[model samples]
Target: MHTRRSLLLTAAAGSSIALLGLATPNATALAATSDQGLVDEARITVQDFTGDTQFTDMRRKLARAKGVFIVPQLLKASFIIGGEGGSGVLLAKTQTGWSEPAIYTMGAGSIGLQIGGEASEVMLLLMSDKAVEAILRNEFKLGADASVAAGPVGAGIEAATTTNLGADILSYSKVKGLAAGISIEGAVISARHSRNAAYYGKQAHPRAILYENAVSNRGTLELRQALAAAEMP
Candidate 1:
């Protein structure tokens, strides 16, 4: 039984590596001149890819999410030889603006083939603060550190799902310029504070950028407007 299980694990890992080959390599470094740049890029990508119709739909869905994290780009590579893929920022809506991105990593397991490779954009909705807080840490793994469940999308949105991480979470995927029904199950997310801080050229905390303020360039005005509109008594 032990040997069989080991073989199965090896096969699953091999399959994941094979799937990643479909992604093209990008030479550009993951650096941002300013938080606004990241936010602007994310907003533009979201609008451009999702289009007015789907973008509107996503926005409405996001608005209803408890929290969202926008990472602009999530570069993922497997340790055991695999292609690399990136996902745009993870954004969570807030009374003021979206929360700063927390970093996490994910790997495919047996039973499901989290196949496909391409630098696509992704959006995650944190249904509970527990999961959100866990992401605030510098590093996190999907299956190891925290439990993750496949997020519901589109018509499946009406159904409620729970995660073992003490929070309810949902995810959606977009490739090139289209929404996909694919589940981002084995994928992980965690904070890249050292890298992110280096990009921003400051000693600022990731939370400051993800939660406290809107760091993107184009969204500053819009974020401010949103905050003003949500001003508390």
Candidate 2:
């Protein structure tokens, strides 16, 4: 158990360092750039996040989420105060269906009980109309404009019975052997204006893509499929 934990931490830290721009240019260049490429990458991550049997409860709740944000890979490296960052895509559950994803960036700094490096899979399910509204803005801080909590995972836990519905959003992170929940209390979620601009051929915001129903799911077939499975009642 001790050796496994050490490996998990080491792997997480390594992923974090490379993703956080602390690695060489070649390593950094491997990070997703084109919007289509990121959408493709995040789809694979979503598969990993939901594939485990342990996520049954969380997956059920995700189906009902007003909007779901997928941070495929979040890297964090720290000695005292560490920096964590990742890029991902968001899909709003429209009246019709899940809309195309809008790319976004999530970042935060921590100085608490964290010691070594960590890489994680971050997911946020917008649980309320107001919570979805809070994320549509230019820059939104978790646990401030809207409440956020780690969604319960694993078997035997009933999503409807275990969750605090008052929370606007439920967050989760799965890191290797440590597949449970983690807090993203102070993280900032922002629309990737440049990526959106380049991808859509103009300046686009989360408002226009997710809320207003301007974009369609052309390149997000896999992601939408994964979300559809999670949404199944």
TM-scores of the models, in the given order? 0.55, 0.80
The list of candidate 1 runs beyond 4 A from truth reads 1-31, 34-37, 48-60, 71-84, 87-95, 99-117, 143-167, 211-233
Best candidate according to lDDT: 2
**On a 0 to 100 scale, what is the lDDT of residue 76 in model 1?**
36
**How many residue-pair clashes does candidate 1 contain?**
29
Clashes of each: 29, 5
Best by TM-score: 2
- Quick one: RMSD of model 2? 6.0
lDDT (CA) for every model shown? 0.46, 0.72
Write model 2 residue lDDT over 51-124, tens digit each, in one string. 77777766778878899888766878887677888777888898878877887889988776668876777788
Looking at model 2, which ten-residue stretch has the lowest summed lDDT?
25-34
> Per-residue lDDT tens digits of candidate 1, residues 51-147?
4344443454455555654433433333444443332344455665655543333333333334544444565656666666666666545445544
